[model samples]
Target: MSGSDVRMSAWGAVGLVAGREVSTRVRSKAFLATTGVTLLVLVAFTLVMKFLGGTGGADATVGFAGQTSVLEASLKATATSVGQEVETRAVADEARGREQVSDGDLDALLVGDGTSIQVVVKEELDAELRTALTVLAGNIELNQQIVDLGGDPGQVNQRVSQAAIDVRPIEAPRDFNGEQMVLGMVAGILIYMSLLINGQSVAQGVVEEKSSRVVELLLATIRPWQLMAGKVLGIGAVGLLQMGVIGGVGMGLAMAVGALTIEVSAAVGTVVWLVVWFLLGFVAYSLVFAALAALVSRQEDVGGVIMPPLLLVILGYVLGISILPGDPGNRLVEVLSMVPLFAPMLMPMRLAMGGVPAWQAGLAVVLVAALIPALVWLSGRVYRNAVMRSGAKVKLTDALRSA
Candidate 1:
């Protein structure tokens, strides 16, 4: 920056600083390395999910022996009706089928020449498979009884199959989509990594300049808040771009690979929300990080200064990742996600889970948005007061009081 830069307006100074940061960091090898690593990880994940069949693996494998081969399709349909995916294979005879089951080639084997459904398992039967088999056996018995009574067994079974209870739910329950759950989880991981990594980039940048006394030189031209805001905005822009690329490319790969079978709109919505929350979370956390980092001129002490807020980020992510997958309606996580401090990590995950009320999502965004101005004022004061004073770690009270 030149001496004439001191005479520039605040916007001009900030733009100049921001421009410098963007140009410098975007060209750096660290940025390239991290972005490359992230993209590779995404590609690997997409491929793995595609190969593994995208959140639906066979619940069990069943082998049909002898004349039981005719029963394979009905058995599969029955398993599916009970929310199980049972893959079936043919065996030459009951002896071979039992051997396959014992050798773990199949989860269960059907035997006894298809007169009735008989299963042999190496161990105990799975509860789900048991339910499906019980239902199948009941249908068979009912058909036999109808045949003995001279009724059309097929017509009677069809009527029985069509019987469904009239469900009168007061409010419709949200059916969590498989794709949404996976997408939400991926969203959480992406945002958490972004905030932890890029948020620190903001702080480390501040400490590096201060420790190197480069801040003093820069300050000669630009005002303190302008310098601070420029750093945040500049780094933020780069991070946002990087994040957008990862989210877009990851979603695209999943879609192309058939791993994400959801509608394009849902996938696009997830990416958009990911970007939105990232901006909000990044700005909110970066402001505080930049301010706290100003208190300590050394890179090592930056961690000490930022640990409290860092824990909040980690806590939010942990709660979201651990609990939300099991119980997306977790009350505590729901309430905490509404808090601005935790919203960045948790809200995006819940949003990706695909059933959040419109008001709730809007409120979380609004809360975080409202908190940004307060952070700007508070962070600006500490950054301004402490950025110029470098040496031993400055007390938080002194930074605030002196300002």
Candidate 2:
């Protein structure tokens, strides 16, 4: 028999469609270009962050005069206590100190005569520097008072140094820190982009097939739902593969560069959650895109019909990245994390923050999982009726009624 006359199993047909989609799109220049560009951007971003600075101790250069030894020692000790490093230069000439400070050779110029201290800067001093100077001044005054009261400052300092306080936690939190926060934000972005880009691809593909009269030939052999399912599944598989590569490579690069400071287990967990949410988010949006795109016979009308799904994705992304970071425990965030429409974005963020209870996360999964079947049923109905119509645009109401 000819290719068109051959009878194929339902699974076989879907696989054929999916394989066709994967091969065609994955080999396309557009796909490779976008992936390459994203990898480059991620690498560049990591480099920029490293170049800006890491969590290493702060450093400052200071020039001092007039009884500089004791005061310099005090400043160094204070700064060192706070994980800061201060380099001291004894400038005997005040004029030379001022000129060096003006020329950017010194962060600040300190003029002290035992009991009193003065700091001169070309411009406003940073809070760290100001704090270091303030601490040095206080220590000098304390020493003077101790001497006046017939006490030894060294003995007092030695005694205070040996005193320490212990802190205990009633309930220890999960390992959520700056690196984990970054990982979470990255996951959210991946979800948003996966749904947005691949959903649009599905819509555009559906519109193209209809406009070109390709669906009629395919529908002659396979049912409409199978075609729709095949298309979404195929495109979504591509998206999943892309997301996996991006997540793996991005995390690997981050760890290699010391950008990701979280532990290995945490990183692996973050990646696992990212993949799960990506699948959930992609499936939720792709079918909706296919159904909506059926209403349009041409590529030009695709944008106007897909607004609702697009808006939902954008809203979720905004909430995930913007408000959720600063206020992960906000009542609104907690509520949204359980909502099917917003869960894909918000849930991952709450997970990253590490305070979400198991029940809440399971509930979110159940809600999102439940919505998929209903959406699939509705979109399948829409696709069956509208996939055949040609020429003018079809209304969603008419599509549902006719189906």
Candidate 3:
């Protein structure tokens, strides 16, 4: 009987093939090593960032000359408030202050000149010191003005120091912050890696099967599409499980480090979104990779033939972390997010950075979802013809040309 005539149900065939693929790959050493290493690196990076400390707490030493008691007090108080350590030393003269700063003995030196102040630094003043000095100078000038206008400088200073501005946005998205950016990046990287790694897994599997004549044996009972679908599904299942581990570990690590605090509902929703996109991206790219691999008989040739799709994945990721982080509203990002090849990577990035309308995300989903079956059908046709061919690499045009 023909393979198709004797084959079990389509779902059964695909599942049988998928099951085999999953079992084989999961047991492989490379998958285990890479997954463990990736998780370790994730944990290591988070711990490093958490314990490394931020820009605050660094010491800034300032040398002063002439009458500057008020400015020195203001500087010390400001630095303390902003979590900066400022050390002040009395210099005999301006020349001595400059010498101290030039000799690296002081970060900066302030010289009182009548009502104005001049600062000397070896290079540029440190940002914390600069801010403190500016505030101090402004307050001094304001106090002089208040005293000249027959008002109490001390009372004005108290009122000014107590005043603060609170900002409230009229229409803001739900608490999207630096933590969300990190999570979004993690999501994008996960998708990119899965697509690049598992998609290539499909390609390499195709090339290996063809090279060893395994395709002929497998094709004995199942159709070409079934084989392709099973491989993609099986490998994608492995990818999904790997992604779940990575995502869970990442979320747990982030929370453990106090870097991220997310609502249970929102966290669950994000996880769902990530899984959905990963499946879509895997299906979209895996079929194409498998079809492309079928055109090349050698493993080495897989990389050369897969350049186009690989570039698309790279471009999407590059845009995701770089441009999307800064300008989520960029015309290019908006345009690309709707395209099937780039949407899986960019749409999550956009959603994470906030300001993306529900419809735009929905539209991107609809477009990519609508395109997968068509892609599967087309890729299956290419694979059916190309898998049987051997020797020279099959041109895409030649593969698509119906016999």
Judging by TM-score against the true structure, name the best candidate: 1
Q: How many residue pairs clash in each candidate?
A: 0, 0, 0
Worst ten-residue run, lDDT, model 2?
Answer: 49-58
lDDT of each: 0.91, 0.85, 0.85
Error of 3 at 294 (Å): 1.4
The all-Cα superposition gives candidate 3 an RMSD in Å to the true structure of 5.4
The candidates, ranked best first by TM-score, are 1, 2, 3
Estimated TM-score for each candidate: 0.88, 0.85, 0.79
Candidate 2 accuracy as TM-score: 0.85
- Which tens-of-lDDT digit does each residue in 1-403 have in candidate 3? 7766653898899999999999999999989998999999989877776665343435898887887644777788877877787988888888888888888988888876636667889988888778887877777788789999999998887887899999888867354576667778877888889888998999999999999999999999889999999999999999999989988887778677765666656666677888889998889988899999999899999999998998999999998889866655688988898899899898877676556789888998999999988998899989999998988999999889956
lDDT by residue (tens digit), candidate 2, 1-403: 6768867899888888888899989998988988889989988988776666575434789998766655777888988886678889988778889999999889888875656778879898978878877887788788889999999999998998899998788866445466656767888888888888898999999999999999999999898888988888889899888888888898888888987767788778877887788788888888899999999898999999999879988998898788866765678878988998889888887786677889999999998889999999999999999999998888889999993
Best by lDDT: 1
For model 3 the local lDDT of residue 374 reads 93
Which model is ahead, 1 or 3, in terms of lDDT?
1
Better of 2 and 3 by TM-score: 2
